[model samples]
Target chain A: MSIKQEELEEIYAFAVQLGKDAGAILLERAQERFDGSKQAEQGHIEKVNAVDLVTQTDEDVEAFIKSKITKQYPSHKFIGEETYSRGVSRDYLIDDEPTWCIDPLDGTVNYMHLFPMFCVSIGFIVNGKPVIGVIHAPFLNQLFSSCSGKGAWLNESQKMPLTRNPTPPLPPNAPSGCVFSCEWGKDRRDQPDSNLHRKVESFFNMASEIGGREGKGGMVHGVRSLGSATLDLAYVAMGAFDIWWEGGCWEWDVAAGIAILKEAGGLITTANPPADPATAAIEEVKLGSRLYLAIRPAGPSANETGRQSQERTVREVWRRVRHLDYSRPGV
Target chain B: MSIKQEELEEIYAFAVQLGKDAGAILLERAQERFDGSKQAEQGHIEKVNAVDLVTQTDEDVEAFIKSKITKQYPSHKFIGEETYSRGVSRDYLIDDEPTWCIDPLDGTVNYMHLFPMFCVSIGFIVNGKPVIGVIHAPFLNQLFSSCSGKGAWLNESQKMPLTRNPTPPLPPNAPSGCVFSCEWGKDRRDQPDSNLHRKVESFFNMASEIGGREGKGGMVHGVRSLGSATLDLAYVAMGAFDIWWEGGCWEWDVAAGIAILKEAGGLITTANPPADPATAAIEEVKLGSRLYLAIRPAGPSANETGRQSQERTVREVWRRVRHLDYSRPGV
Candidate 1:
């Protein structure tokens, strides 16, 4: 079910080209002002809806990628945000056919704001498992890629090959620092759950704990919400954040990032308990079942400490949340 | 006490050169790692203490600036962070001699972490009032400058022109947005007052008002703490933020920013009272004692709306802040 080394190299090269192409187009279009009135007229107001934002740009890019993949390997399958939005689903059982998942823009909000943080993410799934991934942030001149069994890498730099070298890792029981990234999803005012209050309260509590009374027990360096999922994942890959937790983002928001983290010896899963009982049964034991805990490649013995640190921080954050009801089962 | 156009121009040019020069030096030296052992050996365990962080680099930069100013204009007086750290009083009374106030590194913690949100702030105090200010964020390639009688500018681009050509003034009743920037400061633990906690809580309440938030009220874009006071002020000048409320920062932290904001038709004052009491005694209400409220250029009609928005937001925030003692107050 694993991808061959030669195939990984090919996928990496293809993804790099695709990412650059999309990045170039975005940069060019960003320089000019679109007719604000036209945008307002074109149903852009519905963009805040969790399920309604599939812009023409998204479809065009997905179509472009599909065409390229079909021409090169007609038998391969494709999974994309636009296609998924249209109710496409695939059985991710171990298989020989390669499955390509793509998110044309990981930070759509940032792109809309012209904030320069969005990026192209591509992942290769083989035998129902992600085996390779590539993410490109062209404006920032950063490219990250990795393949299963091979160490991850940044741009073509080998100095700090995405793998951790043998070094004494910080103790797991040791206090940890964290940077949590969250987005203000569209439904701030009228939602059934009203997750906004809970999210904000959690952020405040965690920040206060780390910056404790005179910042004593506050072992955290700081918390940052850069408003980009791709950049947040990349930061985890770079050891800039100890943990990244989130809920409600779609699979497209995380598919490629999951691959990147895995190849870098990280983990990922659903933030909430799975609706499917089978998935939940297995998730209870494996760290990977929990939503995106990308512990940077620590020394072999340091993994325990990293895991403990992550658990402690999350627990402390949960305790300090004041206004929200966290007792509604598991999320 | 007002500076002439020509003098302002000369000061602006000098400031630009010095800022760029110091920025370049900082970038070069920042790559070298300091001996952690030495820092620990200095008995400077006040790791989170605001005052105990007087590194040699700060002194070196201050000395460099002082010497440069003294050599270029022997009559000008110099005020800097390092000198002020050595037991200087906060009084900045007016004097016949021109005065320069400088903060070598505005976001020292960020600098220590290799984060790119720090800057060099240089301001000119003329007769006890800020007349010219230049804030350079070399890493981000941003430069904000302004002179008395002239408008504020960003990276040579005229953002708020000194002389308004015929556009309607900003509406007085326009709702205002704010960006509250602050640090945890040195006292994370015990103190007579938890000013930071109160300030942050207040900001949250104002930004995210409770139920029935009306008339574009409680609809702040979001809060951003980029870890640099100079950058925060620059953003205010650029209209990126409607209000910037901060505490625990010193004169050096804000001197340059005050000049820039003034030039941009903004206001500044302590966040204690509704009006500057010192200025209340003055015949000219416009020339009241300064505290720190850098407002954007608003049309005559806009003043009422702006004031209303400010008061409502501030009061709402004060209502939510519980930990701090706000009994003693004066803006």
Candidate 2:
């Protein structure tokens, strides 16, 4: 199931084309938002428009993607968000099957508000590993795509870091005081140990300034809940955000982003304290882990100072916000 | 000194041209971010680069704007962010002398980090009221502008709301559950009753759930700190955000936005309880009041129901997250 770098690039280009087509459809539908039909479904609520965003467009776009993928790779299996939202269990394996994971519309809420943070994500997986990824943000007119070792880019010209291709590993030193991103997902069941409490505390920990929150505080510049996870990971890969720790988003949300991010030299680990990607089998990272700590992309040649600085930041953060385990053993 | 509608429109057009020229400068400088030379001066800190940011660009842009204004009006008094940052207190009269409020660069941190949320804000004033405003976000390529009675607009082609010219006043109803925007200003000093503490509590209150935060919890959807006060107001005027509560930003940070928001049919008041903007003296709402609650814009001829719905949402939010008074009276 090993994909040639050349094959992956071809697939990556195709995925990008598919993303562009899907993005065009999404953009047109977004403008009709003012038509107002608040049919909130699949946990997508527009308190203002009350639109029945049961997101028919979501399915239509996915269907379009699957049709295009099948035309090229008839044997590739497909996993779409709408299907998972329809109650499909999170039990798919990246095993032998060549798969195309799709999230027709990531950031549905932002799309509902026309807040300019939604995207079309497509990832190609084989032997249970992502080798090609494409994330197109139509409104922003920026597209991020990657093919394993071929390097990652924005619109295929602006190599990430916009400083150098393949960013060096984070400088190892004390955390450089980062701005973070987190979210309070739709799961609002409240209790002392509930997801709501954990997220609130994590957010507070990130924004709490020096001399606050005891040992659990962070010198993070701030925390933003932009109501979208894909953009969070994509932006972090771009080095705009320092980290994105989450426990509620699904596989489709991270699949493509994880692929693109890795290509750019970033690491993704569980959100809990021991999120040591260094020791974990990279492929063991699950779509259902439900927790991810995405650090900014670094370059392979990251110098000792850079590595130490980045490691210092990571260690400090892990000490403060520990996440509850949501991953199962041996997928 | 009352400005006629026609005169205000002309001024707005002139102000927009100034903003465009200024925006071109800001955008070009942003490209040279890797060319970092943090000059720690005048409370501006570029911790990592520590290059001499002694922002000659800020001065350069301000001088550019002032020269253009003097050429046009010849006698207009100008208040720029860099000048204000240089110790000119916010105590000037909104006197008969036509004045210009400028923020050559809003969201300086976002600018420093290349986060795509910064902008150039230009506001024209006469007789103590903002008559014309222009905000140009070069990266986003979206320009928001307006005159008192002519209505707000985006790129001057798509009107604010982009659908309804003037949005209907918020309907009278329980808090329709809003998406909020907030910021943690530079003053991080903490105390049980300090402004820092109040902001932290207010932020937590908005995001806390049903049984959370004692009686001080709101059902607001989420919050974002995009690092720019002017853009926050401009977006709310565009109907993308519901409320922006701040007690740390200055007049220049909000003057242009206030002019744009008012023109779009929105309300501006103190962040504390009983923020009655309909009766608040327009001039009394100073550039340094330091505590302003900007409501979403409403449509012309808003129905009673719409007005009450919007008011209800506002009152509900105020009840949950009340601000401590931070304003000085008798301006």
Q: How much of the true A–B contact set does each candidate keep?
A: 0.01, 0.19
Q: Which model scores highest in DockQ?
A: 2
What is the Cα-based lDDT of residue A158 in candidate 1?
33
Query: Model-by-model lDDT, in order?
Result: 0.55, 0.69
What's the TM-score, to 2 decimals, of chain B in model 1?
0.76
**TM-scores for every candidate against the unseen true structure:** 0.71, 0.87
Task: Give the Å error, residue A33, model 1.
Answer: 3.7
Taking the tens digit of each residue's C-alpha lDDT, what string does model 2 give over B1-331? Answer: 6666777677877888888999999888766543323211134545333211335567788889988988988867888877765673546545666899888888766665556778999988887778789999897788999887778888888677643533444534323346577876555444567776777777767666655678555655546677688998987887777778888677788989999988877777667655653343333345557777777765434445544555555666676665664544345
DockQ of each: 0.15, 0.33
Q: Across residues A178-205, which tens digit of lDDT does each residue of candidate 2 receive?
A: 6577876655544677777777676666
Task: Flag regions of model 1 displaced more than 4 Å.
Answer: A34-43, A48-100, A106-194, A209-219, A256-290, A293-331, B1-3, B33-59, B88-97, B127-132, B141-193, B206-219, B239-243, B258-331
